[model samples]
Target: MALTIKEENQFKYIDEGAGEVLLLLHGLFGALSNWEGVVNHFKSNYRVVIPLLPIYDMPLKKAGLDGLNSFVEDFVKLKALNQMTLIGNSLGGHVGLIYTLNNPDKVKNLVLTGSSGLFENSMGGSFPKRGSYEYIKERVAYTFYDPETATKELVDEVFETTKSIPKCLRIVAIAKSAQRHNMAKEIPKIQHPTLLVWGLNDTITPPLVGHEFNKLIPNSELHFIDKCCHAPMMERPEKFNKILSEFLETRPNDS
Candidate 1:
C-alpha cells in the first residue's frame, strides 16, 4: 500500500489505523519504507506511526542521536502520542533508548532490532564511499545475510543519498555520535518491558550486542533470527513481525 504521509509544521510522518500506537523509528540510512512491513501488519489492530527522522536534512551540528531523540519527542507531543509501543531499528533504536530514558512514562513497551546504543561496526567498518555504485551496493547488501535482498532500487536510493557531500557529512557525524554515546549504564534503569530482536548473522551490531542489551535492560528479552543480518524487518519481515506480535500480546500487565 502507498502510505500517506501527514505533514505538520516541520514534521512529516505516516499515521495509520487506530487503537494502540506503534511509533516506529528508522536507522541512519533508513526511510519510512524501512518499516513498511511492520506498519502494514499492525495497522489493522494498532495505530502504526512512523516519523521521518531528519538524518540527511538536520543541521550538521545537531546530526546525532540526541538530535534525533529531540525530534521524536517534539513529534510525539505534536501528535499527542502516549503509551506507545516504541519500536526502533539501528540508529533509530539508539534514539528510542534516549527518548524512553527521559520519558519513561510515555512509553508502555520498547522494541529494538539491531539497535546501536552500545557498539556498532558502522557500514562494515567504514563510512560511505561516494561515486562508487559497486561500493554502495556491496555495503547495502552487507546489511542482510542474503545479498539478493539488496535490490537494485534500494541500492540506487542509497547511492543517490551518498552522492551529495552534505548528506555524507551529516551521516558520518550522526554515526560517530552514536558510537560515542553508549547507554550501558542508562539502559538498566529502563523499567519498561523491552524486546530485543536481533539477526544471528548480523555483522554490524552483531549478536553480542543483542545479548548485551538483554543483560543491561532490567525487563527485556532477546530473540535472534537465523540467516539474517542488520535489518531483520526488511530481510526477514515475517519472523520480525511474528516475534513483535507475540511480545505485544503476551506483554505483562501493568500493576
Candidate 2:
C-alpha cells in the first residue's frame, strides 16, 4: 500500500527519502512547496515528509479552525512516525511545538524556524496593532534584515495568495485562532532535543522571540541567520540546509 495516513481532512503531502523520518510543516499560506529546497537536500539520507496544510490553495475555513490539532492527529496515525524528528516554520512550528508537548513519544528532535505558536498576541499585539495592511507590510518588511530584499514581486505574491482565500479573512482569523495556544506554558513541556532557528532581520516573529524561546525551552540551542528573513529555507537555502544537516548529525538516532 502507498504511504498514507487518514485524518479529518484529506491533505496533500510528500513522503520521500529514507532512514530516520524528518517531518516538515509549513506556515500559513504555505504548502508542501515551501520546503522544496530542504526536502531535496535531505531526501538522499533522510525520510523527509511534507504535509500540504489544508489552507493551501483554499480558503481558511476549509482548513478548519482547529486544523493544527487535527493535523497532529493525522500524524499519529502514521506508524512510521514513531520517534521521528520534526521541523516546522511559522504556524507549522507552532503545531509542531504543540504536538511535541502532547505526544513527546512521537518526536526525537524538534526544529522550529521563525516559528509561531508563541507570542499569544504577536500578530494582533500592540507592536503592529493587527488587522491592517500596514501591519502586514510592516511585518513583512521586518522579516527581512535588508528591506531592499522585499521585492515588489514577493509582496505581490503574498497579497495574491491571501486574496485567493475565501472570504479573504482567513489570514486574520488564523492568527486569532492561534492565540489560544499559549507557548509560554507549553514551552516547558517540550523536553526533546530542540533547535531554534531565527532570521536576524525577521520582523513578523522577530529574533527576540527566538531568544525568548531559547530561554524558556530548556536544552534548546538557537542559531541566528543574518541577512535572512521569514523563510530562510527559500531565501538562504544553502545556509539553512547546512544548519539543519549539522543539527541532525548531532541528534540521537530517530529509530
Candidate 3:
C-alpha cells in the first residue's frame, strides 16, 4: 500500500493507523520507504509514524545528530505523542538515543537497529563519491549481506543525492558528527526497556557494536539476524518485524 504523506505545520510524515504509537526514525541516507514493511505490518494494531528527516536541507552547522533530535522533539510535541515506542536505524538511532536521554518520560520503550552512537564505519569507509554511479552502487550494495538487495532503483536514488554538492556536504558533516559524539557514558542511564536488533553480517556498525550496546544499556536485549547487514528492516523485514512484535508485546500496560 502506498502510504500517504501528511503535512502539518513544518512537518511532513507518514502517520498510519491508531492506538499505541510507534515512531520510526531513519538513517542519514534513509527515506520513509525504509519503514514501509514496518508500517504495513503494524498499522492494523498500532500507529506507525515515519518522519522525513531534513538531512539534506537542515542548516550546515546543525547538520548532525543533535539537530535531528531537536527536530524529532518538536515533531513529537506538535503531534502530542506520548508513551510511545521510539524505533530508530543508523543515525536515526543515534538521534533517538539523545532524545530519549533528554526526554525519558516521553519514551516508554526504545528500539535500535544497526545504530551508530558508539561507532560506525560510515558509508562503507569514506564519504560519498560524487559523479560516480558505480562507486555509489558498490557502496549501497555493501550495506546488505546480499548484494542483490541493492536494487538499481535504490542505487539510482543514492547516486542522485550524492550528485549534489550541498547534499554531499551535509551528509559528510552528519556522518562526522555521529562519529565524534559517542554515547558510551550516557546510554547506561537510559531506564526505558530497550531492544537492539542487529545484523550478524553488518559491516558498518558490526556485531561487536550490538554487543557493546547491550552491555552499556542497563535494560536492553540484543538480537542478531543471520545473513543480514546494516538495514535489517529493509533486507530482512519478516525477521525484524517478528522480533519487534515479540518485544512490543512484552511492554507492560500503561497504568
Candidate 4:
C-alpha cells in the first residue's frame, strides 16, 4: 500500500516488512518495480521502500537536484525512517548520494549501481524516434550487455510508460542535468559506508567509473560483474543480490 505525502513528493513508493529500512531508488526512465527482485530478497529481513522516481512520470512541478532531494527527505521523514540502507541505480544513485550528504545521520550504509554523476555528462544512445517500439528496443538493448535479457514484456512495458513525447523530453532534460552534475568533490564528504557495483560490459557508466568512485568515496567498496550492463539488478539478479547481501549483512557501520 502507498499514499501521497506532499506535493513535491510525487514518488510512487512501496513500504513493507519490518526492521531496518531498505530505501531503493530507481534510475531514469525507471519505476519502483525495477528493484522488485532485490526488494523481495530483503523485505523479510528489512523494511523495503522502492520509490518510482518522478523522472519516469513527469509531475506538474519541475524537478531538479534540490527538488529530488527534498522529495526523498520528505518521504523519509513522513515514514520516520532511520538508519536506512540506501540502494540506488543510475540516476537514483546520484540522488541518493546527494541525500546522504545532506542527512548522513539518517543513513547506515549506501549502495549504488550503474549510477550517474561521475566524470562524463553525455549519455550515448540512438534514441531513434520517440514513442516507437524500435526506440524502446534500442534503449533496452543499449542498457544490457546481453540484449536477450530485456524480454518482450519488459520492452513493451517501458514503451507504454514512455510513449508521451513531452514526458520523454522531460526525461531527456533530467538526463542532461544529471550529465552536467559533477559530484566528484562532494562525494568525498560522504562518511557513510558505501558499496559500488558495476557491470563489466556497461557502456553507459562503464566499470572504470566504479573504480573512480571507490577512490573518491573514503568508506566505499567496488564490485564488478562480468557480462552485465547498466542494469545489473535486472539483468543478473541472483549474483547482484548475493553481493549486496554480503555487503549489507556484514558491513560495520559507525552509527
**Each candidate: what lDDT?**
0.92, 0.72, 0.93, 0.79
Candidates 3 and 4: which is better by lDDT?
3
Give candidate 3's whole-model lDDT. 0.93
Top candidate on TM-score is 3
lDDT of 2 by residue, 1-255 (tens): 133433334656788878888888887745566687887888899988877665543446644336666666575575446778889888888888877877788789999998886662244322223335555565555556676656666566565655443424555566666766667976976788899888887767788889989988998999988888777886788899999899989976634
Writing each residue's lDDT as its tens digit, candidate 3 over 109-214 gives 9999999999998872256468888888898899999999999989999989988888888898888889899999999999999999999999999999999999
lDDT of 2 at 112: 92
TM-score of each: 0.96, 0.80, 0.97, 0.89
Which residue pairs collide, candidate 1? Answer: none
The C-alpha RMSD in Å for every predicted model, in order, reads 1.6, 4.8, 1.2, 3.4
**Ordered list by lDDT, greatest first:** 3, 1, 4, 2
Put the candidates in TM-score order, highest first. Answer: 3, 1, 4, 2
* lDDT score for candidate 4 against the true structure: 0.79
In model 4, how large is the Cα lDDT of residue 66? 63
Better of 2 and 3 by lDDT: 3
Q: Candidate 1: worst 10 consecutive residues by lDDT?
A: 122-131
Candidate 3 Cα errors over 4 Å, as ranges:
124-128
RMSD of candidate 1 to the truth, in angstroms, is 1.6
Q: Candidate 3 at 242: error in angstroms?
A: 0.6
How many angstroms is residue 100 displaced in model 2 relative to the true structure, after the best TM-score fit? 0.9
Model 1 agreement with the true structure over 178-223: per-residue lDDT tens digits: 9889999999999999999999999999999999999999899999
Each model's total of backbone clashes: 0, 2, 0, 0
Candidate that beats the other on lDDT, 1 or 3, i.e. the better one: 3
